[model samples]
Target: MPELSGPRSGSEVPLELLRTPPPKERADAARNRAAVLEAAARLFAEHGVEAVSLDAVAAAAGVGKGTLFRRFGDKAGLAVALLDNRESVLQEAILYGPAPLGPDAAPTERLTAFTDAYLDFLLPHLALVRVSETASPGARYRIGAYRFWHRHVAILLASAPDPDVAAHTFLAALAAEHVAAVLPELGEQRLRAGLHQLGAALA
Candidate 1:
């Protein structure tokens, strides 16, 4: 139960577990968990989530299957960990990047920047993105990307003249339509155009 430190690095465990240890975890457990997450993310990004197995992740991580299961609980849990790792990076970008994204920009301007950044961020990671959508019931707790994007847009809307309606409308209008269908089928330009048009209309 390590707390995420700043915009740099740390673990994503429940806050309540911060002061409590299971009483059985060894010193190497932390290192092994980190390796498993790294390897799983790499394999899933390269071969798609369904294509990678628990055994493959363990092997790629240079750990045993028992260790992988013990660390993550199961394959789905491992996917959640991999996604959480990437989500942390995106969170860092939003919290610490330049103006319009990080802070100090107008609502409309921030909204525009967010759309552009989200499109760029989501384009290459379609594999993990799709897997995340299909992962769990309360996926946002693990995959914070969607919630982050929504909240960014919502914040921009709230800062504007009319917050309540605008924020809800903006989210609905901008959710990916045909672009997030899969890989290669949707180009960046097309997605960008859609986002721009939606942003303009909302503005």
Candidate 2:
């Protein structure tokens, strides 16, 4: 179990774990990586994430399939690489920035703020986010970044009965696949509004 404690708890996973710096790479390796990400992004945007493949990305990047596989492992890993910077920024805000997302607000308010910010993040990148999340069965649960989000929300819900379960339930409502399915019907505004009801029932 993740240590449920204050922000600076020694047992807590380090924020550095989430905001990892890119590994140093030789110029050729770095170029290939940049080229791969650029090509993948363009292809994903144009054809939709589900419609594209790692092979397509590799061909677009002019890198060999072997290189793409070695560098990113798969399409999911490539999506994750593309999202790293934005995820790091969001993590930084939640940990150190300001009220609501930061530690300064009341728990309910913070959770609501998280929902709002996260919806904004999820909307534009829905396709890619879904790809990263649904790469494999239970892939979302296994992601390191998912753990960070879970821990943060679980901490905020610390006063509840089974904050762990509450956190998981709340996050279930925001899963990329679920959101994608509901979005066209609910649309962004109603969708976000519905999600804002995190329910004092949990409290």
Candidate 3:
């Protein structure tokens, strides 16, 4: 029976005793958190990251502005959380999705799968994807995926005429997206074709 009024309402209550909830949450906290994240994602997607403020997120989520800051620390932290949420989906597809993309395929096949998987997964996320690419200490959302592709290609390159040369070449080729940003003419189909040719050459 926690009182709904001023500090004196629970003044007689012991600190630890009042801190404990019957079930740790009154149900509203969990709902509010979910609503907040969902609203953040939607708003961030609709409006660019910089355009969406904490107050807007709170209004969209139906929570107080204080709650948003408390949960996410700050705007950058909120952005990172959104990126993490997106990466989790991509991780599941690559690590546990269909054949070739997952672990069951042959090395060469997985290499191709890696290229295709990234193209498919990353294309839709291009909007939010660019945000993490800029230099930031905690901006590591893409590192795991990039490392996985590099590791897979490096393994396949090990048996090549010059493994070192092949691995570096493969790495350089896979970095086409960075170039794609500069070259607007390179569409998705051409990008995939280019990656396939590069993979074939490295393999």
Candidate 4:
């Protein structure tokens, strides 16, 4: 798999996949992926995610439709690629940053921090997140990112009455649609407060 480098931070994080060398790609193939991502981001920003299609993305990127299809299986795949960098950053923070989010923090504090950080990430990338989730009803739960988060939360909740249930329930509260649906009416402040309350209950 071709890997893209994400922004680095001072703290060292154990991201073995990211740290390891990826299989090399032909120069042209690399260029094409970059082109497609850039074009898709521009088009999505200007026309909105719902208005853009894979065909349009191919045209804008000046790549063949077949190339686009091979590069990204669908719009959801493209959205995942677009969000990869941001996701990596958050992952780094959780794994290696200071207290509250990193390993040094207490379980409750870590859980609270994760919820807040995840919500912060969700707001700006709501469109892409929604696209990924809507690709299939259970798609979000199956993604690699979701698995990582679930594991992290489960570990944090290890001492809880039921770690597995607590972790899943926590993640359910942060699902993209669940948050997006209430965002307009509740606003970020209220929404975050609600999530904090939920986290507190879990803790």
Candidate 5:
């Protein structure tokens, strides 16, 4: 018999419950997830993120409401899912790809490259990025991506007297709301220059 962790633990629960799903179920689940994502993307693209609902997504995907909710807990979850592919690609480049983004360059160069890459990514998906950031109070800082960025920045700032605080300040300057507010006045060129300058100062 398997050991139990608490009085409420179920020692009689079937072992199959703890095991991976059969291949067929796994394939079906994958297909359903893809279909839901595709449907949500198309709906959001045509109608805008604010205008579309999870119910609408479920109907569009031909999946049940329960399935949609189970797959993505809420609209914010859906937004994160939509951004995941692009985010993953950027993260991969940062961690493993060449030049200033990867291990091939100095820490300062990598930091500059990261800021440039992030700004480029943010500009194109301004609406989506904003939605993801503002999902709830302090939501942006709570996300996995935010943590990853913070850690990366902190590592690059290792020589700083207070790396954590400096990292937070650096990232705050690039917050979606802050950028959106200043972008029109500063223009992309000025904003990029300002970010590079900030990075240089931090370094």
Candidate 6:
């Protein structure tokens, strides 16, 4: 549950590790955005993400349906917006915080830390992430967040026979859809342990 308070002094980070903030909003627009996300969060929690609709979110937020669609595009986009803050925290940790989740750890340790930290965020947000990732064919791979994770894992697996392929394989197991499908059977402890073993083998 630990997170980076701020970037470490003198630490340089890759461009991919940087997340671009969304365009600034006007005061009224910002209020609308906040209301939309807040309403969506409540509805998703109350009824599950899959059961909620953009129309419902707009109604709950007191925004026009057209406004919601224009701002977020779709339910998947809304889900992505909702996770932005939590994802940024993890991103900052990987980009500049302390070992083993940050800069300076040995690859094996960093890899393990990454899985553990990722799961910490992911498990609680599984349904939201599953919607964002599985919204379309190859939607997960298309995400900038996925590219950042894949790059980190691929670099850590550089000594492996096929780092690129292995990284994809490694992340495949961690995908929200895949993890959600198996979690009920394997449970969190076994899943974490198995991922640790996989990380060791890949590293």
Could you say which candidate leads in TM-score? 6
C-alpha lDDT score of every prediction, in listed order: 0.60, 0.81, 0.60, 0.78, 0.77, 0.85
Point out where model 3 deviates above 4 Å.
Answer: 1-30, 64-66, 73-76, 135-138, 141-180
**Superposing all C-alpha atoms, what RMSD in Å does each candidate have to the true structure?**
7.4, 3.4, 15.3, 6.6, 10.0, 5.0
> Per-residue lDDT for 1-203 in model 4, tens only?
11112222123232333332332689999999999999999999999999999999999999999999887899998998888778878877876787787667677888889888898898888999989877987999767677667667776766768766787898887888888888888889988888888877876
Task: Please give the range of 10 consecutive residues that has the lowest summed lDDT in model 1.
Answer: 1-10
lDDT tens digits, residues 1-203, model 3? 21112121112332122221222445787788779879988998798766888899999999999988887767655655565655555555545567676556675786787777666656665555555544364343344444434444555555677654565576655443464474367777787888788878777
Off by over 4 Å in 4: 1-24
TM-score of candidate 2 against the unseen true structure: 0.88
> Candidate 2: deviation at residue 17, Å?
4.1
Clashing pairs in 4: none
lDDT of 1 by residue, 66-149 (tens): 988877776656755665655565555565667776566666676777777766655666555555555556553344444445
Every model's TM-score: 0.69, 0.88, 0.62, 0.86, 0.83, 0.90
Global fold similarity of model 4 (TM-score):
0.86
lDDT of 2 at 25: 92
Candidate with more favorable, higher lDDT: 2 or 4: 2
Candidate 5 lowest-lDDT run of ten: 1-10
Where is the poorest 10-residue window by lDDT in model 3? 1-10
For candidate 4, the C-alpha RMSD (Å) to the true structure equals: 6.6
Best by lDDT: 6
Two-way lDDT contest, 4 vs 6, winner: 6
Worst 10 residues of 2 by lDDT: 1-10
